[model samples]
Target: MSFDTPDDRKYLESHEWATTDEPIRIGISDFAQDELGDVVFVELPDEGDTISHDEPFGVVESIKAVSDLYAPVSGEIVAVNDALHDQPELVNEDPYGDGWLLEIDPSDESEFEELMDADEYEAQIA
Candidate 1:
């Protein structure tokens, strides 16, 4: 099956995607939500909380399984998508858009260079 892997972001091997823009946006890839089935809950760190790269920062629970959300870059969380509290299916409906999980002020922009590009990520998942 095919998955949406946008060229605008970098992806973790575990399926998280991170944008390079300021206040970097983070979210699971469409492949992740598809694999997870219907998302039922998302547990996220509050705004202002600091997260370390490659560390677990939150959790996403779906009908099929529960998964830990890892940090793609170390930084203070500037925003959290509270809409997911009541509309968890947004993760499935729009994993790259309204389904976004967090935004952070990156401590090291270099970390983005270490992540897989869309082509590499698509190859890995293939």
Candidate 2:
């Protein structure tokens, strides 16, 4: 099945989003959470931590395996979804909403170009 990439956000091949807003939200894509089965835990970076593009920002543990959550853009983490610490299943129930992982203040807006658009990312996964 093809996934939908909302026009408002930029997507990463790793299945994260970088919004063009003050605080960028990061979350696993619906396709990703579906493939992951039940999300058991999400180990994410703390606020104020700097993360590099295409690098592992944290870990997402599922019943199937532990996957690294990659940064789609370089930035300093501004916030994290505290709810996931106690209720990791949120990632499965709402991969694009309440399941969001973190928010970052991007270091550079141009770095977003390195990420794929909806169609390109869809082709890569296909």
Candidate 3:
């Protein structure tokens, strides 16, 4: 099945996606939510927490399995999707929009550029 691999963001092989916009938004890919089935819980870092590129930042638990959420870039987490605490289904319903995991103030913007583009991400998933 085709997934929404938006060009405005970069992707990790682990299936996380990070936007290039300011206060860079981060989330799992549409493909990942689909693969995981219904999301039941999300364990996220509190705002102000520091995360490093390729490091585990949180957990996404689904009906099918629990998965670790990794950082696509190193930075301070400025915001987290508190909505997920009460409405985990949002991840399955809108993985790219309201389902976004967190926002970061990147310490190294260059890390984002180093991640795979949409085409490369799509190809990896394909």
Q: 1-126 in candidate 3: lDDT tens per residue? A: 899989999999999999998899999999999999999999999999999999999999999999999999999999999999999999999999999999999999889777999999999999
Candidate 1 global CA lDDT score: 0.95
Which digits, one per residue and each the tens of the lDDT, describe model 2 over residues 59-112? 999999999999988899989999999999999998878999999998888888
What TM-score goes with each of the models? 0.98, 0.92, 0.98
Per-model tally of clashing residue pairs: 0, 0, 0
The CA lDDT of each predicted structure is: 0.95, 0.85, 0.95
For model 2, where is the 10-residue window of minimal lDDT? 1-10
Off by over 4 Å in 1: none
Q: What residue pairs clash in candidate 3, if any at all? A: none
* lDDT of predicted model 3: 0.95
Q: What TM-score does candidate 2 reach? A: 0.92
Candidate 1 lDDT tens digits, 11-122: 9998999998888999999999999999999999999999999999999999999999999889999999999999999999999999999999999988988899999999
